[model samples]
Target: MHGLIGQLRTTPGGRGEVVAALVEGARDMPGNLVYLVAEDAEDPTSIWVTEVWETEAAHRASLDLPSVRAAIARARPHLTGMGTRVVTRPVASLGA
Candidate 1:
């Protein structure tokens, strides 16, 4: 399985909106096993996203999806910066 974990820094107090857009965009995506969004405990404007997919190609293809494109555009205004990101090849997982 292919997976990704990333952190995003949003404009002050804007994490909720960004997270909402991301979640909405990911809905019904093919090959998506997991799509989880989390808020940082200490940083109100920081959001973390964890995703698992059946294959790397599916993950790449998601970027071209209309809902994903729209979500990115809608969330752009509130994005301050991208933080750390890491790609992973998952061997096993409980949920995904």
Candidate 2:
């Protein structure tokens, strides 16, 4: 599995827009096993995305998409965006 974990800190008052775009993008990734998105309970402006894809190619494909691009552009203005980390692992280990 190929996964991406992203943590975003939105500018105050930009949370709603960022959340909406993330919701749309999360629903849009194809063949994704998990696209879990959440806002921090303690800090509503913080967003986290846990995404798992079938392959690295699949995840790469998502990066080229218009919707994904749009989301990125929209979020860029609002996010503190420390950084995102990607991980690749065999499917079997998921059960452990």
lDDT of 2: 0.77
Error of 2 at 29 (Å): 2.5
Q: Which stretches of model 2 miss by more than 4 angstroms?
A: 83-96
lDDT of 1: 0.92
TM-scores across all candidates? 0.94, 0.78
Clashing pairs in 1: none
Best by lDDT: 1
lDDT of each model, Cα atoms only? 0.92, 0.77
Candidate 1 lands at a TM-score of 0.94
